[model samples]
Target: MAGTIALPLEEFIASLDNASLPKILQVCSGVYFQGSVYEISGSEVCFSTGDLIKVIRIELLSVSCEDVRKNDKFELPINHTGLFKVVPDEMPYSSIEELLSLRPVGLESSLPFTFSSHSKMTFGTLTLGPGRALTVLSIERHKGEEDQVRCHVKGQQEASAEVRIPLSSRGEFYECGSEECFTLQEIMSSPSLRSRRFHFINTTKYEQPLVLSPVYQVHAIMNLRKNVLKFPSNLEVDVVDVTEQCKDADFVNPLSLTEVLSQPDESFPAVVEILECPETRSLFKCSWLPELNKNQHLVFHKKGTTAMVLLSSLKSRKTQQYFLVSQQYGGRLRRRPREFNSVYELYAASTRTPGLKVSVTRNCEEVEEEGLPALSVGDQLEIVSCTRMELLCESSKGNKQSVEALLCQHLSDPNDVDDDDDDDDDGDEEVKEQDEKTEVLLPLYMQGHFVEILSDNKKYRLSDLEKEFSLPLDVKVVSRDTGLELDPLVGAACLRIEASMLEPTIQASFPHRPDYCFEIPTQWLSLSVSFTKHPLPWPQGQPPKCNIERVTEVTDVFFYEFRIRGNTDEAPPPRPPKRDLSSLSVTKKSSKSEKKSSKTSKAKNKQKSVPTDQFSALTLNNKKRPPAPPPPDGLNDEPPPLAPRKLSEAETATRKAQPNTYVKMEQSIKNDLYDMSADVDSDHDYESMDESLVSMVKTAQEHIVFY
Candidate 1:
């Protein structure tokens, strides 16, 4: 990912200052309040300097008594002074003149700062000494103005005080260059008359004068000589320093960069340097001069001139532009670049290399050493060491093949092989390996998980169960699942490729994570927000996810009983059954005898196959059988038996057991109910469906039972 290229100062500014351009970056917040300052760590420039992200200021002027003295009109009865925050978006159409004509809003003491936040803010405390406080008094007619309440000020002081704090602490200025130590003498030169100067001073919105460029010297020297006018001297000319904030300033001259570079004045001479493109064939090294000129005013500076032009032919899918720069020390007798006037262009450009270890983009974006250029499906290219032009490779496919070959050259390292990158690979300890531009503690947000479950119908255990129950019960689960795919954890559900038609019930709750305030552990607490934003013309989930099963009744319950007190633990008292299960069964067995029983209640009834009951209940009073052994081969079965059944008389007649016996038979029938009924809207027979991992409640309203 290492590369280099030059960019003209003017073009460089344009590229970096795109208002909507979002860069992967981090910043130390610079705002403060209370005894502490708020330092920002986000990449968003929500507020900077005096830009007023959203701060309000209001000042009250004049009182009713002052107006009474002038117009003999007494509107307010007493004290008067209003100052408070006004909502930024709510500026009234009328002026303060009209506003004052109406009744006052409220007392100043009750007025609070316009904005507030729970998280400690980091910012500078713009200090204003009490001497700067502005207080105006008038005998007026108003409730609070009358001092009838005298609550805003202590000691019932008659004088009211109003304070307006300035945004900055000092009004300082620096020279355009390092000649800050120049005396009045050096500033007053005669030959060139006056030198253009800069003034960074600020004064209360009022126009102030400090001799921005020493006009006195220019006037004096102009009166003294004629050659001074002919000298054409430009002093410490505020040559837009392409190296600092000045580079981004819009006031610089367009030709200034060209003037600073040395170029040949003779026949177009060309000097070349090799530019390596990860994908395409290297392009020819352009000369800086009139050689590439195809027009009058413009010239293609290919060597070390600033890069403002992008050659489309030289571009790859992964890159938007690449500059061809000319050499720095060029002259008329040296290389001359031909003129180019396409909407996009490539030209010679120069810029100093930044000293930081961070990797920089040669002709496109700045990237890290390990960064890889995003490549299209099939692209091939190679870097020509001799020519410096990135040449595209031609596969059997031809042109598109060439495009594909160039794209392949974008790989981060030509010599390296690929292996799945580890998750914890960041050069920094706090940032995770795969988490790009994201802080580690953000999702767990001080350590916690965000949970959401998908269901066709909204049904789930809101909390994890701690106790197991015999009868099916409606429950809520609060289980702690493993970390989800990182994207959904920190973003909205729409980001999940698995997002689908199923409605998802999402709740943000925290799991166990240490809280820190300074070095001390605070509460294990985290804040969460939730709401659903349905996708428009929503796309279906990926990989064909399973449909959510509908749940109606919960037939049983499960729960756990425990209490926490710091590190101490306590066992909760056992709960009771909703209804007694002793009366429902036709056959019965003693509790004592049941202890020795070996027949599984399920298999026992399967074998006995008693006659169907006339009435049904939640817990059968029927004889309890030995517990069913595990399925012989370790398979799982569900939903215990429903009710007893009786044998038919025909079956009894066929039976030759010890004595003749008669048994009742239940009618048997089969039907394609779903197809025949047309609107059955049913899938599995609820009563006979196999038990699921979770249980459901029965629907008989009269069968009073507890979960």
Candidate 2:
């Protein structure tokens, strides 16, 4: 989302630097320990942390730190000297007496500190603990005070040797404990600067000098003539180059968005190609002046100027004033800089209290004049009288004015009257009573299905159900079937329209879509309704109706009853008993047996109804076997197992005795057995002799034997 805005590259970099550096410093400040320098090179400086020496690159200081200075130096006790960072507002002091009397409250380091011209010398008071502080100072001098010094040395022979000390060393400048003095430039340039002996601890606290990389060197170009710095002049060129490289990119100027909005009728929308700032870095919205060459460097007028003005004379107000500053640029009122002001303002001529300017921007025009008072809803006001054109009103403090001049005013209620002048207070009581009776109807979410049966007998189902249910049943069912409807589902109930009601006066919101509202009539399609709650007072002789809305999201599949305000007077419909597998299986098997018995009965009925003459000759065939036909005509019944007659002669005798009727019956029995096994859920063997089909086959075989 941030990529959608066309922010300048420097602005983006500045934002990143502001966000990242503070977080890094916060984290480092908590854990950074005092360390001594171990090594220094062109790229990085390594500092010893007792256990390890961490190397910090010189490039990091310029990239992260905003205030970077160069060639500044400081000193410490025990003859230690090194270069230190300098603050932006550093000043030079020549007298130590002025430094000792200075307070350190507003200083960045919260300590007594001073620096010489160009920050060449820095004096600091380090508070090690209560009552224990170290005062260290540094100085820069070109020439040494002493001229030439002579020293005499004698070599030791047998007994003793004597050495002569210089008399110039005891001069006035070498008195007290401050005897030693060295030129600052000489000390900072010596070999001892790289000896790793001095601990320049406070250098990291101040503004470290910048080491500019090639790409970032453009930022170093600032206005040096005014002892100040501004944004780089070539920034506009870089922006144009980048835009040309990415021609398809969106060109949105966040600063000039308001300008674009103000100029809607222009042929082409205005786009800000460059953003310039002064040395203070106070950015403002600006545009290029006319008739300027491409590379001639155009100057801009101060865009918007804001000021904090105070109004000291307005009545009954204590808050300060804020103004939206506009400037007269090129003889026209142009918009001001897009800076935020925290003052709360009504932006009306009536609200401001006119007074002297508390603090004004360099040149800003006041947009609103001051005279009128802001009127609110509950304020008290007295109406004087109405003229031919406008009405007049007076304030409580006796301020009189025309009502037209006021920005806002409240109208007095018609029922209100002066209590001191009125004899009776009955009107007020009547007004209060009317207010109490005025009821606002809210939406009611309801869902319900028709009640089918009153008794718990499974004999009743949806087929015998009524279209609607009401508290009183005998009332002529005003609803008619109209030959337009059919019975509902097997056991489900239909919507009971006759028992439901809706409010006539109030509009009900749609259950599925709360946004859609409509007024429900007192009676629709001549449906009957009865309310169990208290009777509603009717206005203008209108009948009372139900105030309800149905939640269609609650489908009719589940039996739902609306319960409101902890009232559970009506219970939900009872659920049917669930069928167990054992009972289901038993019933299924019994049904099959009953079907078989019915089939048998049907066959018996057919046999009894058949003409006797059709099968009169078959009666003898059906009779019990006449002693096996007298042993097949005198041959012994078993004829001593007469040589198995030729297979064809035996088949002929059997076919002649029993005709195709018996053959058909046997084939039917076999088919029935196969079908019975196939109809079961699991695998079954029809060949195995067992229940109904097996018994039927055995009976048929016995009948064949008898024949």
Candidate 3:
């Protein structure tokens, strides 16, 4: 402090420039007007005596103009384009050397400047009266001769002459007003001119003389604070340049995560403090996110690339879920059997997994006229292909119709194996026996319960399963990750591999739990931290082997973001063909007409009609019924009228006792046909009407009375 020069804060900052920046200043005295606190830009500023401030940056804000006459001050932009003329100095100079030395610019650049003499002086033949003006044109120098200034003198009647004056010549010289003009920027940029006073050229509005000074916004940091402090340099405090004395001063410098990546290699593998916590609680749903807090320390392990995959849990009515998956998944998954409710679903599954085998879950009664095959619960069927088949029943006009059907082989139960002696049979003979199995045609419109039959019990890795099967494939985890303390997928009954992705991430962890690391996807999460001198948690040259968390729980937002990025290449499956409502209505009408005819025929001859029990076992492959022989007279044939008969009292009582039961049976049959038709109509396309056979048989029985 003995040798250092202390100046007002403004003057010290004004003496410095950008090239000599990053200066450290010690506040020698504090300025307080009524109070010690000052608010600037929403931040409190209180500078105490001996406070050390490290000034990192200085920016020109505006030019402060003070009216010298009235002591009034105002601000003007640094880019002001208005010109100002130099005001003459009232004080007179005693010698020519003093006048030239006091100029704002070099003598060579300040040529042709006017100055008037206060008293007449004679230089040989030249004579000047009081208040006569002379302009200095140039400087003259001869060999071994003293330097002199070339002066221009104007005589009477617009005549002018030049004369040389010695540099050491003594005279009472006064600066005269000149026509030269300068902008505010030009005056502020020159140190010598900055000290001079000026006034606006337009005197009508601004008649007062002004003294211009620069205002600077200083960006400084205090030794006791963690954030940089910014304030204007016009404060009334005084400071001294102590940068040389405080060479070891430390200032807080925080870096963002993006900036951390720019740090050198040797800077990594070091400890760091979180000056500002990241707002990632909502962005990433993970177990470790809550651990990130301000002032918490982390071990910034070396940066590298990591390949990751995204797995999602099956969306259910309970909750939809997502995950940030990695290739390090250690669990095993087994394929889960899928269930089907209709033949359409079966066809859809067979297209993906050819040669699919399924077992019927419910019994289906056969309808021969409609081509529906009988299927018993637990019956096994192997789907071969889709084909067209002709129905046993004919149209009203006696024409046959073909419909789409699934060709399948009804497999026999394994428990009912042939005798052991058949094992020695030739391969050809065995093939022939296998081919003898019954083949059934399932109509596309038929609705029945069925489930996939999974025979293979092999386990598969998640990555391998994704490559081998198409998603959304259903699977159950057979084994849990032994490395993880708590595995989310452990107790899940079933999970669907909704989608997969390959991502690049940064592996990071806290210093307390260095061995347990979580990946920070460089493309997703945003965070910032600064390296500290704190030592590593482990010994020098040896870092503990970390167990990285491969799977991370995420929200549906992550899934939506993945979709928005257009990462998937699979197009949507084509929609099913639209059903023809007109054809369906026509089929309903034809069935109604057929029902009427069957009822009339049954009423005419009940003994000749087959019983309902006999029709239940009929199959689509059965021989078609021969057409009834044409009437004896094809043109006109009438049946004889029935003879009325009287009933006995016992017979009449029996009919009255069973009337409710008979009517209930008829209503049940009608409801069943209506339900079957409703299920078929709900589908996108109806390829066949195989359930009509049961409706025809039930209708014929409605005509028969109990007695």
Candidate 4:
């Protein structure tokens, strides 16, 4: 400390070379420009006196040129290719040795450099007149002889001669401007040349002599600050080299997660302080994320890159969620049937899985004009292919239009097994008839509820499914990961495989839970920490076998972002064509025609008898009262008198068997209402009432009379 000197911050920084680093400097004076704090790059820098700064690195940014006469300053890049000539010093030298010592470069490199003398000089039979120039070509030395400079001289009539001058020769020698040139880099590289004045070779623009100085971007760390500070060396502050005195000074060196990856392996298994907390708390749903606070201590177990698969919860009316599952997940997955709300969705699913079979969840009415066949609840449909179909009914303009439709086969229920072996030939003929009648055409514009019918019950591993099936496949987690303290996917009903990615993460944990580690994805989360000297929580040579958290919850935004980055799937199927509602026309029948049709239907019903068996096949039986017959053809066109509606034998027999079944009248009314609602064609038919509803009303009246 006694031999240390306090130099201006700029001078001390310029004198430093990378090989001699890293030097510690004490701020002898505060940085002030016009009595105010100096700022660089929007950071207010006010280093207090006595503050210690460890100068870790210095980078040569550019060369600063200052005009001596005008006091003007500007900067030139270190790679500037312009040439410059050294300006001669106004003061004279006393000896040849003194003149050679002041050369910008080494004496050998400055050979053939010309100079002149103000007075005449006689050197042992050699005479040099005033204002005569001599070029020192080289230096010569002999045994037991003083060093001498070999000079090349030219006089009147272009006559030239060579001579040697002793090193100790004395005269009023002055340095003369030379025709030789040097670049900005060459001048700045030489320690002695940096102090000399130079002028541009092309004097047209920069005629004035300029003094060149090196400007360095100093990279240092203040003891109070956690991050490294970068500032130019031309600050108006003074510093002293205190590295030797404060050799034990401790500085907090904070490094980002990305920077930590570059550290040596020995740096791990050590405690570290969190300097900057992670800013992306919303991206990850983890308990440790909130605990990652500033100044919190965590033990970094190790770092590694892990293969992860991104799973997303099936999107519904609720918010869609995402999860990151490590490839090491031990849980088993079972394929879950996907649900569709429209024919277009079913078509899209068929593209991914051929021979896709689905069951109707809601009944759909037939639209003959639009080529939409009727669909009843519990009906199974096997999507065969896409084709064009012509509607059964023509448009209002009497023209038939072809539309795109899905061709599907209606599979009969398995419960409808036949037991008639004696009539096998008849049953075979009936089966063929049913097959031909089962082909249905569904237009893409129709909306219906359907659910996928999955037949495979085999369980598959998460990784196996990801490899075997293309993503966006739905699955349910049948088993939970035992390693995790809380697995979010354990009870999830359905999850979709969004994508797979290889993530580089840092395995870290809290000091209290050194053996329980959570990964910090270096690419996703931004954090900064300082490795501490604190000993590991565990004993030496006995590191804890950390249990890493493999599953983490992420937001839908992360899923969409990942999709954007890595999505390579083909474009989605083209949208279905819009339906033209204006083209559909419904024909209204006249009163006379409606009456004739009603009579004909009633007569046909009378010809068939209802089965008396109690165990009858279950079917969608929708019974409606027949409309009153219109006036006879020759009778007056007057409204008919209201009369009691006639009932079929099935209804009569049911009533007789349950004469005291009035207690069940309410339940029978409910059943009748449900059956009527299920009739798709009865949506607009208000004239007809279910026969059971009428019977329930009559039975209630009769019970009132008896009571």
Best by lDDT: 4
The TM-score of candidate 2 is 0.16
Instruction: Give the 10-residue window scoring lowest on summed lDDT in candidate 1.
Output: 513-522
Inter-residue clash pairs, candidate 2? 304-336, 304-337, 502-546, 503-546
Q: Across residues 139-231, which tens digit of lDDT does each residue of candidate 2 receive?
A: 222365423212122223633222221222221110011222333233233333111112123455543433211112112111111111122
Runs in model 3 lying further than 4 Å from the true structure: 1-3, 109-111, 140-144, 253-264, 274-531, 544-707
Better of 1 and 2 by lDDT: 2
Off by over 4 Å in 1: 1-209, 214-266, 270-707
What's the C-alpha lDDT at position 130 in model 1?
A: 24
Model 4 residue pairs with clashes: none
Q: How accurate is candidate 3 locally (lDDT)?
A: 0.76
Give one digit per residue, the lDDT tens place, for model 3 in 574-640: 2322344666799999999999999998765653353433343243344664343233222245443
**Using lDDT as the measure, what is the rank order of every candidate, best first?**
4, 3, 2, 1
lDDT for each residue of candidate 1 in 1-707, tens digit (9 for 90 to 100)? 00123322212222232242221111113323432222323211122222211001111111111121233322221122321111122223132123222212222422221211122222245332221212212213455532211111111256543322222212221111211222233323222212222122222421221221221111001111111111111111111212222223222111112221333333111121111111211222212121212111221112231211111112234322222111110111111112212101101100111110111122222222212233222221222111111222222222211011101112133223224555544543333222322211110001111111112233222121111111111122122212211111111111101001111111111111111001100011111111112221213332212111111111111001101222234333222112223432322456435644645676556544532331222235746543432232222365433333445889769974442111111011112222333535556322332222012212222243323
Angstrom error of the Cα, residue 676, model 4: value is 44
TM-score of 3: 0.46
**lDDT for residue 636 in candidate 1, whole number 0-100:** 34
Model 3 RMSD to the real structure? 19.8
Task: Estimate every model's Cα lDDT from 0 to 1.
Answer: 0.21, 0.26, 0.76, 0.80
